[model samples]
Target: MSTKMIFINLPVEDLNRSKAFYEAVGWKVNADFTDENAACIVVDDNICLMLLTKTFFTTFSQRPIADTVAATAAAYALALASADEVDVLTDAAVAAGATEEHCPDKRAQEAEVGMHGRTFIDPDGHQWEPFYMAYQAA
Candidate 1:
């Protein structure tokens, strides 16, 4: 089967601010698909995001956009290859204005599941989890 690319679409109140936040956290914006109303954040070769202004985003759906500040519509999670990378990404997100989702004691849940990660809420209140999971060879 052919590989399918993933494009996550998020509606934002402020296009520039949201774009800046993503850029500050190290994701490159693809100008090829970006304009004043939207930006394409490249997470990788196969995964990316289309950050659109609420007004522009609404054109795709009849329903009103979810108020991310008040309710979480979904959580975006990225899988890292190493535990240290998880920490680095999380720290970068925090420095870039993302809020931690869980408390310190509960943030690292590696011991129980062989997975370590951190969750953060972005400026627009979108939840993101950067995690690492060790693959056990059978």
Candidate 2:
């Protein structure tokens, strides 16, 4: 089967707050699909996030929605074009009220090739790793 991209549903205790946080980081909402129960955050042409209220979110799953602030059940990572961009984005995250979980660090083996990364926690404590991997000559 051919693969196509879609949305990721994140259960949030406060839909408005989560929506605001993402908006501060430059995500746009798809009003056509948004309501009091959920907000469709557009990440890219094919990527999006369905930010659902906790009550509405539970309806779609048998398992309980994880408390992202209390425990890390999962993490989302994105790569940057350069190590400097990792630092730049991390700074922006902090300015947006995200907690800096770790300082930027270089991977020893990767250091020679200039790869580096850092981690941060969003308003709801979701972990995100923004990293940069340098190109290597084949």
The digit string of per-residue lDDT tens for model 2 on 1-138 reads 436877888888788888887887777898999999999999767778899988999899899888889898787777778878788777877888799875434345556666677888988777877878766721
The numbered model that scores best in lDDT is 1
Segments of candidate 1 deviating more than 4 angstroms: 103-110
- Name the candidate that leads on TM-score: 1
Q: Give lDDT: candidate 2, residue 90.
A: 78
Candidates' lDDT values, in order? 0.87, 0.80
Task: Report residue 26 deviation for candidate 1 (angstroms).
Answer: 1.1
Checking candidate 1 for backbone clashes, the offending pairs are none
TM-score of each: 0.90, 0.82
Q: For residues 35-128, write the lDDT of model 1, one tens digit per residue.
A: 9999999988889999999889999999988888898899888998998988888888899888988756654445466778788899988999
